[model samples]
Target: MVNRFKDPSAHLEIADLFAEHDRSSLPIELGVSRRTLFRYRDLYVHLIETDEELMPNLNAARQDPHFQKINERLGHLLDRYDSKWTEMEDSRAEAFYDWVPEHRR
Candidate 1:
């Protein structure tokens, strides 16, 4: 499914959050430097090591196919949020530009 997420960054950050499971199957698509992805992977492993609660949730959520659907919907809404952000950016002017020193140009 096309990710509907608002922030593309979420694709990575969130995927990493779910990585306690093998959710690496889904992949975190947020644009990342290879180094950052590796770092997040390390962080995920650390979280899994320290937290007992996350392990079961990972198992439970993975078994539920519905969680995949939830991920899709979450991505979709995030896309909408991105769209709104674009719209807002398009509508903007330098509201404070008038306060600038002309000589600063």
Candidate 2:
């Protein structure tokens, strides 16, 4: 029975359907026992988490085009700010060194 659902999408769809329907009637509709349905659901979630092909689909937020654009823009902004931060730190260090007395050095 498990072998029949080799495709990750099928596994996910059936599992989601079972989740939405009454647990007692699920076996009647799916032609499998409740325990088997639970097992399949667990298997499907595991595949979604670990399988390379299905893993990307699990991240709903990252799948959004708007979110992707925002993420890219934020990355660029961080890169620009990081360079300025590094320059500021370097200048502060130089100023600290110059302020130190020769005797203290």
Candidate 3:
């Protein structure tokens, strides 16, 4: 019999697995790559941020220990990139101005 948990289309379920387990081990458990796990997380965050109908679920996720751990890991990754992003902003100001209208700049 085919295992339902191994369903390839179960993106959300895989995301929940990532949230509840050690991220390093989840890829092996789910039989997917770390990159796939990251994509699931990005999609999950997009849903939480943009899907108004999911607010209740989002609130529950926020309270979940695994969710919190995933969130913290993402936060740290963003923090690590923030400095480089700021430097890019400084270096790319001319390019940004060239691309953006004066009113929007």
List per-prediction Cα lDDT, in the order shown.
0.37, 0.35, 0.38
Q: Tens-digit lDDT track for model 2 on 8-38?
A: 3454455444354424432243333333332
Per-residue CA lDDT of model 1 for 16-90, tens digit only, reads 544442444422222111212222311211112211323344445554665566555444434432344543233
TM-score of each predicted structure versus truth: 0.23, 0.21, 0.29
Flag regions of model 1 displaced more than 4 Å: 23-105
Candidate with the greatest lDDT versus the true structure: 3
Per-structure clash totals for the candidates? 9, 0, 0
Candidate 2's error at 104, in angstroms?
76
Collision pairs in model 1 = 4-75, 4-76, 4-79, 5-75, 5-76, 5-78, 5-79, 6-78, 6-79
In candidate 3, what are the lDDT values of residues 1-105, reduced to their tens digit? 001222335556555645566455432433333332323322222211121333344444566666567756544333322244432123221213326578996
